[model samples]
Target: MFKLLLFCFLIGITVGIGLLTTFLYANTSIVNQVFLRDKYSKLQCIWLLVFLTGCSLLLYYTFSSQALYYSLIFMNPSLEPLQFWDALWVVGITDFVVKFYFMGLKCLILLVPSVMMSHKCKGFWYMCLEEISQYYCTLVSTPVWFRYLIDYGAQTSRAEWHFGILLALLYLIIKLFFVFGQWKTSADVLRLFFTQPSYGMAATKRQCSEAEDICAICQAEFTKPIVLVCQHIFCEECICLWFNREKTCPLCRTVISSHNHKYKDGATSLQLRLF
Candidate 1:
């Protein structure tokens, strides 16, 4: 009774996470961990990963041992005794391919959200990934164990970042092809667009003279101009604060009819021209 109860509890916990992971896999809702908000959800995914691997391994050994019993081991006339040479040549390839398969699968859960989220996470991207992961997971038909060995095995220490690297390579190949085509077309368009005779000589070194306008106060670029309603310019920031009340031009010191004045740009440059 005690052991059965423990088993039931573990099964319940696993089912809960399975439901949660499936639901939230696409939900970008914040994981809500104070410091690790963006990353905590991923860390939580560690649970799904453990569950997947354990189930896969258990089912795989069960089926394979039973189905391929004698053929897998005892030397037949064909390929006797699985030995050092077998391990070196045959096992190496098989192991790599199998591991690679799992790593590739790991990429679905690992890289999809990770790469998708930060810069630009789109709904369609997740949708496409879900369809693919589910589709392949279903198509394999073999127990999930086979999928685990092939995909997950490649993801770990056996090939450190194996799937990530492979996925990157695949993307690079695709991007390079797309980029090459785009550049080829853009180059042709650029050639035709720039050939018009109205286009002045390709490269004329026309020199520009810098304006010598200097501020009256700081003597700066006059870069900071405070032109007034009468089109008179002042450097009020450089000047004293009393000018706002003066209602008169400073340089000419002419008393203006009204206190309201406009900047040369036609803006009511009130306090802006003062303080």
Candidate 2:
């Protein structure tokens, strides 16, 4: 009866966490879609991730032996303590590692190009890793205590408590550092967008064709127009906002750069003075 109740409780917790993860994943997908407008198929990826994560957790607490057998095929850990919590412990650890480690690896792959992954990918990975770690820690702490309660009818040992606390603290520290870095990088990128003048601004003095004066981005008159290296022009603010989500110009699909591209802001100061 005790084992059954414990199992039910664990299942409930797993289901609840799964639901929360799904909710968060959906919210993130929606936000990205609104802001990015189909630049990438991130929603599909998130859906896959959420599905895999929930499946991992479900397999861990329930029918984890098959997964463990395949996952640890070469390791050959002894399973003699099956009647005890050994199987559960192995399942929990394996599940946590398989799911979270791969997710972390994906995030690392995303980061290889730039730390500015602080954009959207960073937060997604952080939330995912945090969830995985939370589940792992709970699994690590709960089973031993529950086993003690069931077997000896006593509380867990002081050593177990200390170990659990230390593990939790360590995980907390790592999560905090990661979250801080992500937020800091995101803030820096945002600051860059706000501080720098747009490449389009250099073209404000140019004569507008009946169509050229209108900004494609905002569908308004270019108030402080900037020109891309590709010679496409837009309102400075509009282009800057667009560039935050995508590096390419809205019209020509030319990749805009923060530096070194020639801009045609109508005329130079020398030309103005000469005129």
Candidate 3:
């Protein structure tokens, strides 16, 4: 039961982090756009690998001493010990690679902030040494927390377990709300464009003229183009992808809206949604 709870906690943390990153990436800023474009954006994949590796390690530690070996021998009376050793070697090497990758990511995350700060200091060497020391200390310190969590679980304190579960559930609820808002916005946008009888499936050349001859996203000739409220045009998929991240025109950075321009109190600015 404790092991099950531990796994649940880890899964919750993974999902919470993923949702947070997705929400942040959905921003219309240049930074987020670049991040989306980059092939190295694989936080979800990394988290999944880490989760699987951790579970394997945990199970290995729990049963490896005698229990696991005896069980394997009893289950397969004719199986050769040499074959077991061969399989273990393969699994061990894969586990080491996953662990190494995770450690590298952790080190990179810690190092980047310190390196960014080092440029502002005159004592460059001292700053570099300090940053290096800080990173090492942090790397070492993480195991202490893991040890504490493991020890706490062994003690089976209900209060701590309950609190952790509550926090994770809260994060999941917030993630659900974010997802709902995103889906609603997308549905509304699509309905506004596709429901037009005259435009129907494709925009006329006159409408297409509002955008450039080429799609900015794919760098190809405009195909199935959609004109944004800002008069900037892009391929239907390309612009939708951009809008999913941010509610703004990519070229001019004008806020996107389906409402026709309106006049009220002499204000001509596009009215942003409260959400």
Residue 127 lDDT (model 1): 26
Each candidate structure's TM-score, on Cα atoms with residue i matched to residue i, is 0.23, 0.36, 0.28
Residue 100, model 3: Cα distance from true site in angstroms: 17
Where does candidate 1 clash, by residue pair? Answer: 75-80, 99-154, 101-150, 101-151, 102-150, 102-151, 102-152, 103-151, 103-155
Better by lDDT, candidate 2 or 1:
2
Q: Write the per-residue lDDT of candidate 3 for residues 123-198, one digit (tens) a residue.
A: 2222232233223322332222222333333346778766645654564566457656555544543444344211
Best model number under TM-score: 2
Q: In model 2, where do residues sit more than 4 Å from their true spots? A: 1-154, 176-187, 193-199, 210-224, 236-238, 258-275
lDDT of each: 0.34, 0.47, 0.40
What range of 10 consecutive residues in model 2 has the weakest lDDT sum? Answer: 266-275
- Lowest lDDT 10-residue stretch of candidate 3: 261-270
TM-score for model 2? 0.36
Model 1 C-alpha RMSD to native: 25.0
Using lDDT as the measure, the top candidate is 2
Put down candidate 2 lDDT per residue, 1-275, tens digits, no spaces: 99997995797577547644644554354334323422535545565456656666665556455344343332423443333355444544454444444443443433333244333233234334433343334334333333332333124577765665666466556655755655654454444434543444367455446356888987888766767788777766566546544668788788776531111110001110000
